[model samples]
Target: MFNLSYKAQRYLILFGFLTIPVVLSLMFSYYPAFSLLYYSFTDWTGLGWEMHWVGFANYKEVFTRPEIFSVFEHNAYYFVGGLIQTAVALFFAVILTGKLKGRNVFRAMLFLPYVLHSVAIVIMFKNVYHSEYGSLNLFLQSIGLGSWQQEWLGNPHLVNVSLAFISVWKFFGLSMVIFIGALQSIPADLYEAAKIDGASGWQAFRFITVPSIRSVIEMMMILTLTGALEAFDIPYIMMLGANGTDTFVSKTVDMAFKFQQAGLASAMAVVLLLIVMFFIFIQRKLLFRGGE
Candidate 1:
């Protein structure tokens, strides 16, 4: 038997534990990513192995196609809704952090939607947004506010907004939980000290609470941006990307599967990836500009 030092044995064990995950990551994540990048420059129909290098033709088409690029406008509604959701979540998190009764129950109820199946949630909302027989419209009529009812998923002016609201309602609870965790991690003494220095409630929150949870807020902002850019399920499920509710992701999926334009789809994916990365970089720079 060969003898080895304790340090060498530990190193070997560590490497053994990491080997499978590293290999799997390279195989699944990196390899597919690189392959996608390569295919973006080629004309592959995604049906067979046949592919031809087409340079930036796919990229050019993506840029030149007005209808293809215009789907990004739909993402803006979700992005704005995500911002509103974050703000609402932060507000509730702050409130729940206080000595409120039934706060735990409230938190659980708030988080319930996130744990539910995504497909079920979408289907439920589809029924809720039905033009003729939706519960929303019925409730409005019952309340003598029937005039407020409109075609939620049908009207071009309101379809995106309707879908965006669903995203906010479904995901805001998760953001609230995260914000609550961040808020709880903040030391109570900081607020006490601020109060001792005669800081007002708004001043305390603005200065101490905001700065303490700055990193979490930044994370939530990044999530909001990415989620908006990746909005697909609700719009796709409810309206099938009709009535101007199509998002960038749904368009990409259509290009890839429905149209069999694999190369063009890959290019669109790369474009979305670049756009997400650019926004994330800009977000990081702006959020951490004070070196926090």
Candidate 2:
């Protein structure tokens, strides 16, 4: 038997620790991703091994079809909701970071929804959005505002908005928590210095607070954008993508599972991945360029 040096033994131990994770990643993540890319160019029905090469046909269908591309319009609602959610989260984060009475309780209340089961949340909202028996409509009626009641998940015009609101409500607290952490890290002396320099509240927040938490804000924005683009849970669980509430991910799922068009679904998945990557790239560029 040969004796090993300390550095070599350390390297061997590190390699052993990494081996399982690296192999698992390759098998589960990379392999499926590459297989999806390959199947995008084939006529695979996602069953058995009977697939034929049909290059670009799936991609062509994805791009040329009006109904297919139109689902992105639904995604826009979630994007808008995400923007609203980010703003609200930032506002609450700033407020809670201050010397407010019982701010911890408020923070816990806000964050409770995020920790709940997603299915339970959807089911809870389903009852809340029911036209006749919903809590929202009932409250409106109790407040003598019965005229404001409408089909939240039934009307095509308002369905996406309702679903988007659910997403915002579920996720905003997480964003608020992240923002709070970032805000808390900013030095207290900076605010004092700004006060000493006769900086008004708005002026200090604009110049000092914004710049200080810019990176956290940017990260939250990216998360919001991606979450909006990949929105599937709220809409799918609530209405199964009915009444014009279908997002890009839901549509892709329908193509693959419901329609048995795995190839087209793969194409759509690839397109979604590319779109997400493109936006992330643009975000990084803007961040590094400092809005230039």
Candidate 3:
């Protein structure tokens, strides 16, 4: 009877401990998310006490609209561009982890951009990339590459690329830090063994460093992909005053606030959610399998 009382008391204590967070999460997070999912299928204008059932109409509109599709394409550009940045960060991480001079100072310098306010960073880049009276153009003209200077953000063909370059600059520091941690966690004896086996540095990296950091790389890839998909702040701030650039790349904020098309904006949000889920599914299959 005493043992049973003790067991029951222990179970009660554990349940008492978890019940608060569980209730709070259900009330705050889970319920709101579920409400959003339900609202996505309805024509809820985000105001008013009434909603209309619309089935898949919102999704259909999202797919049939070229502007919306362009948003997806721009998001894809971000994904690919972030991956390139992550790769470059990993390279730098490897070098910094090696016997390099003033490595800590270099790492701190590289990471400084990430700590700055994103709006400030974008504004700084805006000045740098200005078509007239800009430093970039001035330097280009000085070097006889005058023809190479162009309105970077104004050109439709280059706007997304410009945003991507800024994103890479702001985010590469995070990837570098992650990669450095992963590199440090690797056992040095493995590298020494490969060296004793006459493996070149590249060969050692391929077989030792790459495989050892595979899990960390996968985690960073997932984070980068999600961050890119939901990118809003930098592009929003940069393209605020522009006109006729209302492609998917620039209309997200306007669709939500300026136009007050809450249902449509909710639909866009849902599409973004599905994209993240798809990537997560793919990551689970390709990267998280076999307990790695």
Candidate 4:
């Protein structure tokens, strides 16, 4: 060690610290990922080693079927729902950051659900959406809006929207928190300067608030896009992916576990991964490249 240069000593220590994580990552992450890719080309029931190569058959099935493609459409509903959630969150964040009474309490109340378990939330909403005795139907009856109430979960047409609402309720708080942080990072003097220039509230918000937080909004869009595409849990738990509520990830799980078709599930997974990666690439090029 005494004979080694100072830079060499630092490099050696850094290599020692990275060794465990690098080895673990290769064993756990990379190994399973490559295995999934390989499994996509084979006929495996996920229960045995005796499997035969069946290249592209599963991929062909995934791309050809309308029922499977409907899951992709459901994913788009989730994405649109997230955009609505983002807009609502942004509105709340903007108001909360302004000089208003009890804003902290309001923020805390709004953010409460973001910290709750998603499964628990899903279970709770499952009951809330019940057609017969659910709170939603009961409330509508109380308000003389009984005609407006329909089967929130039972019907195929309303199931996706109902589930999407649940997702928005769960996630908007998180979006609000992210927007709050982004709003705080914006310079107060900009608003002050705008006000001095006789800017209206709407004008300041449109020009200053929106433009300044462009990057954060772009980040949220990417996140929501990916999250919506990969949505599984709430729909799975609430509807078991039934009645137009099935999404890409939920369908993948059903295929792999319920039907014991690991090869087809792997193909679905690979296709979904490619779609997500392609969107990420587009967002990176347009929104994130060469800048913070």
Candidate 3 versus the native: TM-score?
0.87
**TM-scores for candidates 1 onward, in order:** 0.96, 0.96, 0.87, 0.93
After the best TM-score superposition of candidate 4, give how far the Cα of residue 74 lies from its true spot, in angstroms: 1.6
**Which pairs of residues collide in model 4?**
none
lDDT of 1: 0.92
Task: Give per-candidate clash totals.
Answer: 0, 0, 0, 0
Q: All models: lDDT?
A: 0.92, 0.92, 0.82, 0.90
Q: In model 1, where do residues sit more than 4 Å from their true spots?
A: 1-3
lDDT of 3 by residue, 1-292 (tens): 3557888989988999999999999999999888777877887766675888898898898888886776566766677889899899999999999999999999999989899998899889988889998788899999999999989888878877888888899988888988999999999999999999999999999989988988888888888878877777787788862533333535655776777666676777777778789988988797678544
Candidate RMSDs in Å, in order, are: 1.4, 1.5, 3.3, 2.2
Model 2 weakest lDDT span, ten residues long: 283-292
Candidate 1 lDDT tens digits, 65-179: 9999899899999999999999999999999999999999999999999988778998898789887999899889999999999888878998888889998999989999999
Candidate 4, 1-292: lDDT as tens digits: 8799999999998999999899999999999999999999998999979789998999999999877877788888889999899999999999999999999999999999988898899878867888888899999999999998889988888889898898899888899999999999999999999999999999999999998988888889999999999998888888887677788898899899999999999999999999999999998897667554
Candidate 2 wrongly placed segments (more than 4 Å) = none
Candidate 3: stretches off by over 4 Å = 1-17, 241-252, 286-292
lDDT of 4 at 24: 97
